[model samples]
Target: MVWTEILVPVLGGDNDAALLAIAKALAEPFNAAINVVYASPSPISLFSWAGEGGYGPTDVAVAAMQESADRGQARCRDLLASLDYPKTKFEAVTADDWIGLRTVSRLADVVIWERSVSRGHGFLANAFQQILLDERRPAIIADKPTKADGTIAIAWDGGREASRALRRAVPLLRGATKVVILSVPHAMAHPCDGSRAVDYLADQGIKADAVVLHTQGDAGQAILGGVRDLGADILVAGAFGHPRLQRFIFGGTTQLLLDSGSPAALFLSH
Candidate 1:
């Protein structure tokens, strides 16, 4: 479970620097290849033409779209050139090119996605969600650079998703100066205690301390506070641990974490 290939999706925005900085920090230790991708939307859909007037010409619309995509690609290349990370590889592809993007994601050990990308509902958002949901890969949601050797916190709940996350985070945890398992006892009934998670990490030769949190609000808030208090650079947790229906309407812990502006980077697996 070592990370060898890291994927970072870019949109040619000013935030690309922040995203790449996070990727570089994660890649440096492992000597991993950073795949910097510029993902653009496909040509304008047929139904999305002039609303009040008749539909516009298809060729013109597609040409305009391609021109915009070209500009985005240029921006990504320029940024990569400026930073000059030795192990970075750059590519530009359309978000609708599912087969192509999925193939690239398949080989990636972990994807580094920007916080804004997760919040978006556009084409890039669809691509980001597919990489996690359809591909079933691990990801690091970051808004800024994360410390490569800082304390890492695992949000443990004794669920299948949490177990998967813990297992996937082993390689990264091995490098952390400190590891902590944060559990919310009052949030939900756990199948097993946080000690089980700590023991599992111990088996992997990674010593971790477990702390039970008694919270009055949501589990997500408690976990965030715990990470902040511990000064952890990264939070390892399962994405969408609750049922889809429940999270979709009322928003679950995963949603809350994703929407948060916390500085702590999230290492999530679904």
Candidate 2:
């Protein structure tokens, strides 16, 4: 159950390094190919130039985009070449933000992205939230687990999503030194003792402790506190779902986690 391809969608800024850090940490050890995709729409997509000199303006805009893509690819190539890891490789692609990155994500084994953790309805944040909510989206590597051989935590709720996340995170779990299954019964729809999750991991040769939390804040905060208390370097959990309007009014646990400056890597699934 090794990852073959890891997709990393970089939107530039400080996220570039943050995204690469997680991708490298996860991919290097597994010898997986890291695909750093940059979503930069064609320059022509930005404007409406109907009264153009025939097709000259359109051609110019497209050429501009092509050149920009080339330069970006060149930088990636140089960076990868410098690393020169025979097992771990790198590839770069430029595509339309709406469809291309999503397409690539569908085929990837896992995705390591920047947990920007912003408290705004910005485009990037919205796009990332949409991805997290995508049921078809692959397993994600978040908050940057530089290495897998560390304490790992799982937020358990006796739900399908949490179960799926545990399975998806097995590869990394294999290297964990300690596993803590934190069951926050506060706001959970199907609260359990977390013993089943612990037993399941034990069956897979991963010993874990089951801890049911009784907290004052929401379930998300309880999970956060549990992770910090356990000294876990990575967190695995199912992404809880909510109505769109409700999420807009009251954010879901997964959304809040995504927006926090997490101290551990978060592996979440829908």
Candidate 3:
């Protein structure tokens, strides 16, 4: 269950060093190859141009976007080379957003994304949204550089998505200095036994602690608070158990954590 290929999107041309630092740390454990990709713009659809008079203005716009992306692509390659991950090989490529990033992710073991403060946060941008929804690959948001010896946390719900996320995170779990299982007990019916999670970790020869907390407010907030309390640097969870629309229309736990972006980093699987 070790990752072998990691895809990193270097779109905005900011925070290259930080993103590469995290990628290098993770790749060191498994000798994973890093692919730094700069996504070129997707052409407007036929229907889109029809509504906006014609392709007269559209072609000009597309050309401008391509030019900007080309500059960013050069920055990405230069940045990656400077980092010098002596352990593994890395490649930098330019491609259209739909076919390039998405296709690379489909074959990658995990896709790495970093949000730079200089760049405005575009949570639901088309390229990001498509990457998140691409069921073939899991994505990791490296909000902060991982510690030299980091602690890992897993948010558990006894559901299939949670289980999937946990399994996908085996590589991280094996290397973490400490592991914590964070759970927020339901105010309604029976809650999962937190000890079972601890026991499961024991089976893998990994020691862990379980922290169960009663809700202080929303269940999501409570769970996040628990993660902070434990000082876990890396958190793993399943992304959006509910449909994208359902979670967006009515707030859900996953959405809450995503929107706030606290606790530094998360390894999420859909």
Candidate 4:
């Protein structure tokens, strides 16, 4: 139930600082290891010459790619050094190294992904999807680092996905100052009271309040409103509880929450 490994992926962009800050905050309480992965494509893949003919690139091209990758890795190391967090490891890998990246992600308790990265394009976005769907691990999407000991709100529906998310967030709930369970009957595909969730948290020594929201609007909007009203720093819920195909095309509550501009971080499990 303890979090020991927190996997964070960065592209050596301006977002690295914010992403690492939150990762460190989540790691401090548990003395967890922050494995910062820096993934970028090799120069060979960027040009067509390597793939056009059955010939490898010249030594000069290979060296140039290696130098670029080294610089990116060095910059990332500098950023981590400036943060002054001791329990951290920086890894450099090609963007196409799915096997290597998954090995790192599978061993992590949770993966921290920047909000913008999820909505972004190309390799990083593909990696995010693979880690969440293929790997089936809990993920936290954040625009900024949330308070480790702040209030938390849970979106409950008495379903397996929500329950799984709850279970994964136990360590965090135990550390929060306050926990609230928000249930919207009209907005749920299978609505149920929040008593069971409240009781479960109670058994875990977490005091929580169950609030039934009577909203006639979209389910995502209702949940977001509740989180804001409660001033919760983080929202815990199941991701893509519905059919993936359906959610992908027409979208669902999960998409809404993901696309929201809310500052609150999301702890999601599928």
Give the higher-TM-score candidate: 1 or 3.
1
How big is the positional error of residue 105 in model 4, measured in Å on the Cα after superposition?
Answer: 0.5
Q: Model 2, range 146-252, lDDT digits (tens) per residue? A: 65788989988888888888888887788888888898776766648899988898888888889989887888889999888888898887875556788788778
> Which tens-of-lDDT digit does each residue in 1-270 have in candidate 1?
578889988888778888888888899889888999887777764335565588765787789878877887898888888776788898877665566677778888899987776776645677777788789789899878888789999999998899999999998999999999999988868444599999899999999999888878888999999999999999999988767788788888888888888889999999
Predicted structure 3: lDDT: 0.70
Looking at model 1, report the run of 10 residues with the lowest lDDT sum.
Answer: 43-52
Query: Model 1 misses residue 211 by how many Å?
Result: 0.6
Relative to the true structure, how large is the alpha-carbon lDDT of every model? 0.84, 0.71, 0.70, 0.86
Residue 186 of model 3, lDDT score = 76
- TM values, all candidates: 0.91, 0.84, 0.84, 0.92
Q: How does model 2 fare in lDDT?
A: 0.71
Top model by lDDT, which number?
A: 4
Best-matching candidate per TM-score: 4
> Which is the better candidate, 2 or 3, if ranked by TM-score?
3
- Measure candidate 2: CA RMSD: 3.4
Better of 1 and 2 by lDDT: 1
Model 4 C-alpha lDDT per residue in residues 160-264, reported as the tens digit of each score: 889999999999998999999999998766758799999999999999999999988887899999999999899999988888789778998887898898889
Model 4 per-residue lDDT at 266 = 96
Write down the worst ten-residue block by lDDT for model 3. Answer: 115-124
